[model samples]
Target: MTAPTDTPSATPSTPPDLDLAVLHHLRGDLEGAEAGYRAVLAASPDNATALNNLGFAAAQSGRFDEAVELYERSLAIEDGATARLNLGNVRAALGDLEGGIAELSRATELAPGDPTAYDNLGQLLMLQGRIAEAEAAWRHALAIEDGPRLRTALATAVAATGRLGEAAGLLHQALTLDPQFGAAWAQLGAVLLLRGDVASAGEALANAKRLDPDDPGPRRHLALALLSLGRTDEAVVEFGELVRLAPDDATSRVDLAVLHLSAGRAAAALTQLDRALEAGPDDDRARLHRAFALRELGRLAEADELLQAIADGDGEQADRARQALVDEAS
Candidate 1:
């Protein structure tokens, strides 16, 4: 995940004009904040705070290139932790992961005790798959300030390292701090799923879904948990809803098809597999599943042809196709 942009607070050292800009930013008025920051810069062209804040406003508005330029300008005028952090976030948003890491590390150096900077650095490190470094950075941030968000981030890094039990403990702590934290609940649910604790995973995911109904993360995990518990009917309903929510999601379509097939609903499975294949024509799993659905529907010729083609391939799916052919012969 890209690190969130910084919204620097106004300190006593802030100029009067820049203070107004900070207020506008805090009020979620990006346009007003940008205009106010521009006004401050117009009067005092070298105001690092104005430039940095404007960069933040631009970044929030999705104008990443402009945000980067503004942040660079701010850094040129006066090197500061805020400018470096904002620049790092913008660079990460732009897909420059290495550049983002460098800027965030510089931000940490500029503000050695700033937990936010360390948290941002940790996020970038995690994105880069540097789990050990990410864990260290998150631990540093937690040492400075044990916030719920930081704990969740740390849990993610720990989970990536396969310390799922420890990760679950961290997410549990995060939820205790803020029970309404849907993300923490969702993370805990995922960790439980990894541990094969389907019952607990389902409960946690349901809580996450209740807290944030619009989030697809909890819904996906909840569906998987239901499937693991042998509640294929309930899993089918959840997967159906997921397909509706994300029509173009080939993976969900395939998952729904599998549940339908398990329920002996070959026709319904065929429909979903057809759509999945249309969305991802070269998907071996979709083709393999489609062949099974076709065979179940008594379209033996079509099924045999597809299975033969799949069996000829040197992929994992080929073994399944070959097994199906053997079962048919028997």
Candidate 2:
């Protein structure tokens, strides 16, 4: 959770009550903070800092709607960057991505030197799938304050645009700045895997897995890396662990099924494929692999029927199915 910056009112005359309220807010005493802020507001309704702090307390209490109202009131009283930033975050939490972006953009303009506004704007843009704009925002933030978190964020947007080499360099820079950043290590592993540097990818992913044992992402990528390295037994073990971690993931089940089929364990492959299909009935990969498993088990008639259906479809799986049919006939 990003900490809220309940800045003191920029007014020349700072009231002691308002100062105490800020202290209460910092101490996590939302009730005391609210009472103190309200007391200040009673004396000076136009106290923008008090209003902003009250909004922060409301947000901490999960009263986002109230926080939005208070932030808007604070902005109307005095157009401060702090209120705009808080309002932007609250609006994003309320699922108003465009509103959040607008407020954060304004906050950035109001405080051009503040990196937090740019970082937040980048995040909202990323959520909206505007990758180029997100990268630009993060780049601006990085220019203001070069940090590992910002670099990692920029690398993510960079990678999304197919600039894998540039993304890898950014990740390396972030790791150098903070080697303990598991997310950067995981992202570096993914980029390396995409570049077909499976050995390096596996090593990075293993480090990520060791650092964050509960994260399934590193485990999943590590399994794929091991599979690409032709360490089938190790891949199977990792995939098995992945299955345990995310049982409802049809893609992981299909991957495990593929590994089973490659190892000539047709029965085991069929079981995993069945589960995959159950989880995602429209999964063409599971159905295609199931046909191969059936064929391996000498269920040629069922296999041909399944393959014919898939062959009539339009996709990579369909092309593979058509080729399988030709092979069977030949």
Candidate 3:
């Protein structure tokens, strides 16, 4: 998991009781932390520090509503950037995107030098489809802290704006900053693929796969890159790995079936398609591929029957099925 943008820490003005509570929170002793904060609140009910720390504890325990109330009370006593940031995240978690953005924007104003506020604001903005605003916020964060994670985030925003070349450059810089960053490698590979550099994309995606072996995303893209490079066998291997990582993903199963059919492994393709259809019975693509697999297995009657059903249906798949029937008859 990524480290939190803001961590609660004891400041110079922090009271001893609040300081002890923070230590308990840091040690994962939530019950003890809450008790400690409650003890402080018993004597100082309006204590902003105690309220903020307690709110943090509540948020950690998935009590977003309670956390929001505590944070609001804390902010009423004192408007601090930390409390504002926490409120923003909790509000977002509770499905209040506009409210979250409002709090995070205030957090940025409260602490202009704090990169965490900018980074978090950018994330909320991105979620709202305000890509240009998100890019600007991320740029502010990058200016304050030149880190690989920030660079990768900025690269994603840049790529969304159709500047693939600049996005690739940012990803390259991120890689230079941290060579072991798997996400950067994956992003860079995807950008390269979009630029039509299949071989380079394959190399980058391979590195990402090696770094995070269980992640199906790099494998999925790498399979396509290998296919584009005419390395059908390698693509098959990658897609097989993807299937293992995400067994319930019917799309990957269909993709694997298509590859198997291309290699004349009709029986193998049929097995994958059967599983895909079982997982998603309404999947027309899988059904269509299954028909082709049947044809390759010399079950022409069954294949023709399935094709006729699909051709009688609506949309692009039906069109393809009609064409297949015409070709088979010809």
Candidate 4:
């Protein structure tokens, strides 16, 4: 869930405690902020801004129920646009999609000129699979205020509708608007990869990585692009980095194992497959790959037993396991 930002404008004169609460919230001291907000509320029970800011602090602290209650009280006290927006986002985080849409829609109506409201509403719509509505909302946001983030969001909505080329163009425009936008570069790379332009995708992903070294998304896509381009060694290196960044990611470990098996490194493959199984014991693919690695190590009996067990199961992996058994017998 995106952390809610404080918008303390409803109160005509901010009390000292309210001001201190907002400062604490901005500084990430949720406890201090909550205390200050409660103090303000004690003094002025009808302070809508204090209520909203307290809700923001609560949401940041993962107290969604409290945040929703505070936001609802704030809105009841005063129909503030920021309160409505925060309520919408918190409702979305709580999986109340319809309720979130209603609140967000109300926020847009209350603040027609606010681009952020439209953008946020568009994101919730996209999450609900209402792509057309999302696209329209994003377009509305762009019309009100042009920015790289909104443009990129619009591009994502466009891409969801299968317009990859147009999405790429929009992402390019977003980059032009703000060349330092790492997210745009990463998104451009993802769209290029979907278009089967591995080389260009690699270049774009590289740029994204350069811009945001701490972001794992660009590196993950870059690894896939490299693998698709037959740069297996480089792909393995990138996958290693991904594993390092997200040690609990079984999928990356399985992927790295597959590459190791392809490169005839059965020992390495087995090691990765073991780690993958530890992370996700239900991963049939990792189990099957482990059997393959055992076969490569000349442990035929163990491999055969694993294949037979998998073939007996009523799962999608059964057919592949049966085929492996047949191939082994031949």
Which of the two candidates, 1 or 4, achieves a greater lDDT against the reference?
1
Model 4 segments beyond 4 Å from truth? Answer: 5-11
Off by over 4 Å in 2: 1-45, 57-63, 291-330
Per-model lDDT: 0.89, 0.90, 0.91, 0.89
Off by over 4 Å in 3: 1-3, 298-302
Steric clash count of candidate 3 = 0
Candidate 4, 4-47: lDDT as tens digits = 43354435478777877888877778888889889989988988
Instruction: In model 3, state the lDDT of residue 257.
Output: 97
Worst 10 residues of 3 by lDDT: 1-10
Worst 10 residues of 2 by lDDT: 1-10
Residue 3 of model 4: what lDDT?
A: 45
- Of 1 and 4, the candidate ahead on TM-score is 4
Ranking by TM-score: 4, 3, 1, 2
lDDT of 2 by residue, 33-54 (tens): 8999999999999888888888
Name the lDDT value of residue 93 in candidate 4.
Answer: 90
**How well does each candidate superpose onto the true structure, as a TM-score?**
0.91, 0.80, 0.92, 0.94
Q: Which 10-residue window in model 1 sums to the lowest lDDT?
A: 2-11
How good is model 4 by TM-score?
0.94
Highest-TM-score candidate: 4
TM-score head-to-head 1 vs 2, winner: 1
